[model samples]
Target: MIGFVVEAECMFYQDKPIHFECTACGKCCTGNAETHYIALTPTEAAKLRKHLEVSEAWFRRRYVEHLTRDSWGIRMHNGQCAFLDKHGRCGIYALRPTQCRTYPFWPELMDDEAHWQAEKKYCEGINRGQVVDIKVIERKLKQQAAAEEHA
Candidate 1:
């Protein structure tokens, strides 16, 4: 027998033809008993403020809750995102944070096959939908990582 070594193209995403698409089921937005705060960044806050035509002070008071010195997360109401409407639609869908924009393809999730598969239980868009290229996934992950770095 001959021995050969091969390297994986991407250490994070092992599955081929990476696929994902948001089904807009809103499960991600619904916080559980364990707390599902959406970590918000200054940039995200500003965007949301402008979208809602609210002052920084007003927005922070109404939508954001300080989590720590280095970061802030969304305030949940009845164990669900405050921005999530009664119909389970994001009130600020267009202005959702980077973390919400990148769900199942998260770095930690992508780093492990089991992690990725486990997400399918809640996120219907995980294993189905359009075949996302690895490059796009990497870009989203990189952007998310950068945003989280500030969080």
Candidate 2:
């Protein structure tokens, strides 16, 4: 009896330099309904509230979904963020959350090449722009981890 072993080329690795630039497609704002929810830190919520000139109660009612006693997320409108405008732009772009600012670089997506490839299907910006600096990726990853820890 003969057995065969197959070797497949690995297309992505953590050390491999990658390129990503937001196309402003707004795909990242929409996610699986059941598991997709943006975690907001207190500072983020406050920043958004201030930007919109809305009170906490008013903001919560119009744009927030309470996830837990200590946590909440931006409300989803038809599978997309309520703040996502008709032009596929963030309505509150200047004040978007840490999650949005550090997108595509999320831990789950960067943990493996397969995860990154799966995300590429949703994000046209992946592999379309300048090669992302390894330092930037590390910094962004650390920032995300800190945000999670604080939240």
Candidate 3:
């Protein structure tokens, strides 16, 4: 019997894919030493409301902060997401914001190697899993962003 070593190819915005399973590292929630925005959709908002057993308006009031007149994202407390629990898990994982669900797969954001590298610096799990199909990623990104727009 012989053992073989396989090297993964580096691919971004192409067939070279990456997958990630959350290690509960909480680095992604901490916003990379700066404030980053995580936008939500109405569907996500409703789901979070159900999870938290609160009204949608109340959930938004407590956990979300509008960044500008036309943009919004989650609010952070002491560098971590306001909704991040002490155990380093999302309190509303089932209904987490679209932004949270789309880690390492933001189409608009990861247009080039530099952008991908920037994301990798913050998310330790970025290149750790099985290769993800690029088309699947693009579809998810489109669905999430469109859903947000409609919401």
Best by lDDT: 2
Instruction: For model 1, state the Cα shift of residue 70 in Å.
Output: 2.5
Candidate 2 structure lDDT: 0.79
Q: Where is the poorest 10-residue window by lDDT in model 1?
A: 1-10
Candidate order (lDDT): 2, 1, 3
Q: How far is candidate 2 from the true structure (C-alpha RMSD, Å)?
A: 8.0
lDDT tens digits, residues 1-151, model 3?
Answer: 0110011123345544556555778788886325576776545666666877887678778877776665556778887888789987787677777777777666544455677666767877776777667666666666555555554
Of candidates 2 and 1, the better by lDDT: 2
Candidate 2 backbone collisions, by pair: none
lDDT of 3: 0.65
lDDT of 2 by residue, 11-46 (tens): 243468888988898988998757888777778889
Model 2 residue 143 CA deviation in Å? 0.9
- Give the TM-scores of the predictions, in the order they appear: 0.85, 0.87, 0.73
Which should have the higher TM-score, number 1 or number 3? 1
Greater TM-score among 1 and 2 belongs to 2
Residues forming the 10-long window of minimal summed lDDT in candidate 3: 1-10
Q: Which 10-residue span in candidate 2 carries the lowest summed lDDT?
A: 1-10
